[model samples]
Target: MPDDTVCDMWEVQRGFDELGRPLRDITFCVVDLETTGASVKAGDRITEIGAVKVRGGEVLAEFQTFVDPGTPVPPEITALTGITDRLLYGAPRIESALPTFLEFAHGTVLVAHNAPFDTGFLKHACADAGWAWPKFEVVDTAVLARRVLSRDEAPNCRLGTLARLFQTETTPNHRALEDARATVEVLHGLFSRIGGLGVQTLEELQAYSAKVTDAQRRKRGLADRLPDKPGVYLFRDDRDRVLYVGMSRNLRRRVRTYFTSSEKRSKMGQMVNLAHHVQGIECATDTEAAIRELRLIAEHAPRFNRRSRRQRRLHYVVLTQEPWPRLSIVRRLPRGEPGIGPFGRKELALAALEAIQETFPVRTCTDRFGRVPTRSRCLAADLGTCLAPCEGSVTPETYAALIRRVSEAMTVGAVDVVDALSRRMTIESDLERFEVAATHRDRLSAFSTAAMRSSRLTSIRTCPELIAARRCDDGRWQVHVIRYGRLAAAGVIPVDASAPAYVEALRALAESTDERDERTTVEESETLLRWLESPGVRLVDVVGAWACPVIVDPGGPLVELAG
Candidate 1:
């Protein structure tokens, strides 16, 4: 039988110090069991249970119990395990013994020679008793042995053979505690082998034993230099070309996954196979890390990063420059000209244009030079939809007043626009014009979305610098320094830091950042602005103030036709 003291003496030395709890710090519940038969589905029952709770190779506790089978112990089982009805007389039943064993094993990883057989029986017992089982990370010495030991060293990885080959003082004798003790020694031996391969944490140890290819295993060193923090990582090929870019709260853990069997995507497989090096860019906060990832993806245009590789299609609503300024949808805004959108879809942009046309009698004709048309008015003028500016019916000053209202509605998120549309819908419904009411409702939604976008864009465009902070869940303040809509600098300040310390950090961060405003695109600015406006963030300071004018609510009518 396995030596109780030998299992007690086997201690695993520590491994890499990157992320997560070190292997030695983890507690392991080494378990073993003897059953009435081989298969639980065939009505087999556990006869005895043995488990050793160890941390850092020191025995914390031990549990062993005989479970009354409530039936005859088969003669073959009695022969193999030497457990019989006589020995189990008046013993606690399987259901009764499980709770105490589970309590002993709580919050520790369960280790067994053949984990499936041992864990499966325990899971069935829990199900039978209707007890809620705690989530436990299970480790199989059988599986670990296969990865760590060669067939030449041990023809098979059964408990007896492994114990003998590893020269454990104890051997498996079909009894519970002796076999469990032997398995513990085997576990320590395998851990030592994997520790040399850089398996340092419980998570890493589990992931390393997965069905990773030899080629992938050879490249594990690629992740050795990565920092264990929230940041972005770039996977590069032997040619020094970026293959993929990803961000994670734990950079080393995430990068390691790319070369492990856990990466199941075909593209990911190809990327890892070609990857020769990994580069990490550490960030102060997860929010900053995410934003930096967006900026980097845009700049590098990595081939394997399918998303954010191309600019998102955006449309704008601009008032055409003419004596009679009329609303139009455009792809690009003219420099120095005011516009309403970077709308995500052409359909939404068109809807906003139609909404403005329906509410105001702005001229839609393309004519210029303030000349009255010799021809009769077009359909829009004939229907009083326009002021008939092409027919010289409206003065430029009067037309300019109407255009000004449109600008106010779009840029400042003027409440007048939404209120007007709401009232128009209500009036049309009261008049039983359901189709007109529906049109007004759709227009209001489009208009509100556009107004919100315009407000966000305008706030950052007007500011030379914006300093904002949000309290993180960890009690650190996430500080963002933005200049002209682009992220300039970001850092985390301790919530308990003094005023002077905070000011010095802000100054240092600002000085360290190089302005890349020229490379800032619409998406980059929008992403930063969206985060700034998110629920948790509080705007602490601003270099140049941003303000929006109050708009008088237009509640009287939906369609005001005056020119």
Candidate 2:
């Protein structure tokens, strides 16, 4: 309040106002410290403190003091900071200096280049002096610079580099007051840079860099309007092109995560930079939201979504149309042929095929010699691994039965073949035929994985109306309504909600779902089963019979039928 004070150049206003206080109206204490060393844990001490209290881009007050560190300054520290021992001969100790600085910075956000370095020393000083440091909000200009400036503009977010880049009126000279003055200029530069990004509030400023802080923060306004409900969200570029598509149980919460530190994918950061807006489509249930997400991703083919961008080219293990129906991998299901899979990988399907061949004497020959052929048997027949229908060695009806068993192995579960392979592997390994044992082991693993995956898909596929419920943390049941393998609806019913009422509601929801016999994506089926199989989930109701021919064990292959 002194008339001769340098801060008299501008009027200082305190407290929030209508229309929310503009960033320019907010007060900030730009601070800097000259320390004897880089770390306080190593007994480093502040030799000098400097802070400039500013509002509306003009200085309101100034605070500066030299502190007697109670130890001689290191020669390197004096060289770096330009604060010699003589300079601090009559300085007040940190205990006294802190109170004066705190008074000047009262009711203001503290800012500094690399804030933690300065704030850490301040907090340590206060605690050492047996005083509680007031919980003042601190902002780091370095973090702001990283968000605002490109690496090309400033190679690093060093205070000196930023001061030079911004061409501040005062140059930092290793002196607290001068460096603080320079930081004040850098702070204003950052504020001006981020203002266009719509960071108008103190809270937004504090959270600016924590989220999509770069030019991507400009899209922060887009997420603000999203409804806080289950929905599909699309991140669109400047031309209104979708950059990414996603689904969330809570639209607002999920969309906001992209802009926050929780989003760690490197490509996501780049995606956000290209995104100019976020659009949300609210759904009646999480199940519907997820389905919508898949459809949107497929439609838009957004460059950012890694999965479900295209209709997957699924591989199926099918019986080769021959006298002896040998197992083979095919990209599409052959008409009128029973097969197992839409397996994601051909190699896996082949492994499943190999396992069936190893277990059953179903011929491995790629010939359609129905009943008999003039040609002789191949290597597989010579090894007795094939029934050799081509040579009239096995009847077509008998080979059909072997093919039927392989189909059963893929659809219901590979229990028989997997068990046989395990015994074979054990015997071979015990005899030290390690190579043969290893082949059996690999085939067993591949067959089990593919068969179980296909079985889960089939289980869901068979259900015309499926309702699964999982217990939420709050004792509510999160129910999913799945019709014809696609998620139709989802809802959370309170534990206290009457069971009759809940079932009736579910019935109504299920009836409203449009049923289609479309092939479900492997990912879609897997996601639903994962949630259903989670520890506390239960099958609440089934309009159509819901059954899995195999019991899924988290630790092993399909053990048995889920009776």
Candidate 3:
């Protein structure tokens, strides 16, 4: 202990105690550090450590030293620090410096700006000296500046800012001892602002410091992954448990979604944060990825999955929605359809969508217009591809046909869905809904590219299929079937396969209304295939022998039947 120290100002005995009796109080050491760099891990080394001990608000003793780090001082660091090599030419090493600083700070709390860096350096120094680290509390003035003082008064809580604000002409050098003394002055301004109550305790300051540091690090960009490709991914915890499952086409982009700045507040985000790690499965194509994703979601029943309803039991069924029996996706198993389970909801949706694309397919998903409308120009119309339903280039029934195919494709088929959409696109273009035509065109293009790249189709554009049933007030309940590649909805026909010219009459009925009905009756889908292969006697319902117009293969006029 130096008797001739500069910090001997705070030791006067006060007359008033808690009960108004003469009392003695301990000192607090306002400390500071000069370091070669910011980090404390391996390379950064401390240059100096200084402390000023004060008792009852008056300085009692001073401790300061320049430690000769074994490493050479970096020139850039020396420039910023203003502590050149010559300053430490014969200074004592950390081994000699730590014990002196420890003795000065022994009975008092240690206060500093961003105190962790200083305290951590001291701990390492103590560890080096074979002396056990001191068990003392710490206080960071930065925390107090934020919580107690008005932000405007301490806009920049740096030491220089506080010095200027307090009107203290104490020119701050990067010197450790000088900075320690300047901080004591800064402490006065800061304490005066807080009414000297020290709103935050030493432990609170350390916790605040750790939290702030972590928040800053999180802001610097290792927290999110953003890639735009189709793929499936998994979310796992630190223990390697697959806590959740997810799929995305853009592998990296999808993974980065969890870190969206807005998402952290969501419950899903809390779960994502809980997941300590993630892994991804890349697919060559998006459609495949979409299928795989659906399958995975169902299989895992992940806690954070977005689409999970009606994921299973996607089979051939009917909905009684509109007067014309507007086709809808069948959620429950009807007479047909295969097994469920295995995939997430996405794959389940795809499975039903595939069957409809293949069988009794027709346009189910149409514009607001029942018929395809005609318009002068839309984005699609302007591009010379679609007939805008809004302006009426497409007739209601015709538009309905196109929608039927899209709707049916949604419920059935395994073929590349883009193909069925392409076929519907061609139909729309032929009918003049150029805007819709353009979308179908784009969809077809994407499908063509996808089908080419991957050897699989989401759904194929199979011949449209038709389901006929008697109706009450509504028109004949015809469910455009998903017996082909993709499902499509079309106009209904109320008919009974009986009488002399039954087959001929039905063919005429299907053909006369073929503009819309032709999109129905996908006689080639597995459902129809199985149906046609059944042991029912083939009766030729001979009307006029009209050939199957769209049948490119060696077949005669499309026929209907009677016994």
Candidate 4:
């Protein structure tokens, strides 16, 4: 095979083993191990283990025992397996049982309905006893069943049914011994159905499980598999190249969906064609999943995913970039030199001066040439809100002080910044910086803007912060924040950190902010608010928060729609 596109493991096997022609005579142990759950990594104790050996298609001997699970079995399991907490309360543990079973079945293949569940338990059991895990061949009876019967016709080819298929005459319950016997018979039936072709050795079968589309791969397993949960999954090629990286809320369901539903994912076609490899890392939380997926995508840049572009952006308040840095709004800070910059072109940078006109009724303006225009009580001035720079009610210096307050509200946050400002004003008055302190005194109203001056308002925080778009009941736009403030390690916060499911958070934030925007100090973003209240507004967690009505000279196109 060329180094081409890849198919899943089982798909790869069928490439050569059409119709599953066997390769050689093989000895197998029809085996069963009762464990706590699906994870072999988690210490799940097996209380019972059973094995029936067969060579040349004849019953050889049996190994069966109840090993104390080291922990009490829950009542539900006790009922299912009929292995009570008291039944094995004083029984010999696996350390004692394993040596005997290994010796009896040594050199033979291990077979089970779902081979991984049994083998994983056995491996863990062996490790707990401080023995090296001896690798061996395996045959999954479940896979064999799939090859022999149509699930729709047989509809119920369980171990018991498979025993009937072979006329092995065993109709056992959940006892490990009977199930093992049934599994052995199932394997025999499959072997006979294939014209008594020589079976692969135990080691070969286990290896083939990853590549073959035999009955074992298609049939449902006797053991319950892992649950569906949200997380990230990694798919690797035969050479261990990360073939694909994706995130999903339901981990098991999502992964299986790729294989089980041919229509849902055409990867099955690709998987079958190349018999590729895949494995997964499950994230504990959706946030973690999104973050991990994005990081992996960026790091490896898998062929299947579209790459994200790199751009320098700032969610900030901008004081004019020119002389004395006149105060105003900056919606989005642009890509520019990594410095206190007036980067990009200068026109868009100047448009922020229009904030004194378009947004706030606050009294402030610049001449058409974009300098502080002739003094007039800009609308804000007559309303007693602005210092009336035009009528000389407040001087250029005094007006600039107020602009700083607007900048803070637009940038850091309206409510939080206003609350801090109110406190700072009292402190400044006592210190006789009363004139200077009033810059922080303006009442929070309909709008404001932050000037991109210092890093003070945009410092990376200790915790993940949330910016939400929301719609008020009255159908107005609003934005809100739920900041857990500042985590220790500081760097450019990666945008891909959050998982896809987390996009739901915007609704919650919208509801929270809309309920309290009037009481809080931050001026909510109209765009965000409308987005929140819109029919399909979804909350998205990003590395940083941004407010609209941005005005910055990113050294790009003019009109200043962005910071």
By lDDT, the best candidate is 1
**Per-residue lDDT of model 4, residues 1-563, tens digit only:** 12221111011111111122233456677888776555767766788888898888788898889888777787777777788877787778788888998888888767789777888788777777789877886667777566556776467756776676677766667888888877777777776654332223333233323333442244222111424454677666668777677777655544543443222335444543343555566653344455566667766777655432111222332445542234454544432212222223233334333333333334444433233445544555556544554454545566566656555444443443334444666788999997756554432111223233222223322114554333323233223333422111111111232222233343243222222122211111222233334563334344455343343336521122222
- Over 4 Å off, model 4: 1-24, 36-43, 196-563
> Which one is best on TM-score?
1
Error of 1 at 548 (Å): 10
Which lDDT value does model 3 have at 435?
A: 92
Model 4 Cα shift for residue 120 (angstroms)? 0.9
RMSD to the native, candidate 1?
A: 9.8
lDDT of 2 by residue, 1-563 (tens): 23343122122222111233457778999999999999899998999999999998899888889999999999999888878999999999988888999888889989989889999999999899889999988888998788778889999988789989989999989899999999999998888887776566675676666645545455556787887677899998889998999988667656766776667889999998888888999875555677678778777788888774335567888777654567778777643366766667778778777888788888765656545566776777888888777777777678778777777776665678868898899899999999999998888777777666666666676677877665554444566877766776676664345544665576676634333434455557666777777786666567776665555667865554331
The positional error of residue 557 in candidate 2, measured at the CA in angstroms, is 6.2
Which of candidates 1 and 2 is the stronger one according to lDDT? Answer: 1
Q: Report the lDDT tens digits of candidate 1 across residue range 1-563.
A: 13453222222322223557788999999999999998889889899999999888788888999999778899999999899889999999988899899989988999988899998888888888888767789999998888778889989988999998888877899999989888888888888888887788888878777788888888888888888788999988889888888898888888888777778898888888888899999998776788788878877788888765456567888888776688888877653365767777888888878777777888776656544444556899888889877766778778889888877666644556666678889999999999999988887777666666666666676577777766665545667888777777787764345533664577566733223334666776787877876877766567776543232337532221110
Name every residue pair that clashes in candidate 2. Answer: 211-259, 212-259
Q: What is the lDDT for 16 in model 4? A: 11
| Count of clashes, each model | 4, 2, 120, 60
Residue pairs in candidate 1 whose N, alpha carbon or C atoms collide under 3 angstroms: 1-171, 2-170, 2-171, 3-170
Error of 1 at 84 (Å): 1.9
Model 3, residue 537: distance off in Å is: 99
